[model samples]
Target: MALVKVQRAAQITLPRQIKDAAHLAEGDYLEAELTSEGILLRPVSIGSREPSPEQETEILAVVDQERKAYAAEHHR
Candidate 1:
């Protein structure tokens, strides 16, 4: 087991050994979750390529529309 200190902004620098063992590299994404014992961290990739700026805008617009529709339906 390894001990690490959380720095400012709640960031902890993963030990070099851990990174190398996990085959992690720069720009890699990690998914973190709280567990009963402690925090769990795992690498994740949403897709082969990241969405473009226009796609992000469209996705947000769809989410906003769905939220408004749900609110209206429930606030009857």
Candidate 2:
């Protein structure tokens, strides 16, 4: 594990090894999760927008298809 110190300005520099492992880039958003073990950082996409109607339909269709498949396999 790599160690990083927080600067006086309240900024922590992501380590080079961690950066390469996570494929992080400048301006990328990261979410910090605090757990009993330690702090976890995860990359997340942030935006303000609604899903397109077509995309919503497609997502529902995919979920329905998966449910059908699951039922067929387990209901046998």
Best by TM-score: 1
- TM-scores of the models, in the given order? 0.61, 0.56
Q: What RMSD does each model have against the real structure?
A: 8.9, 14.4
lDDT of 2 at 49: 35
**Candidate whose lDDT is highest:** 1
Which stretches of model 1 miss by more than 4 angstroms? 48-76
TM-score for candidate 1, please give it: 0.61
lDDT for model 1, please.
0.77
What's the TM for model 2? Answer: 0.56
Q: Which stretches of candidate 2 lie over 4 Å from their true place?
A: 47-76
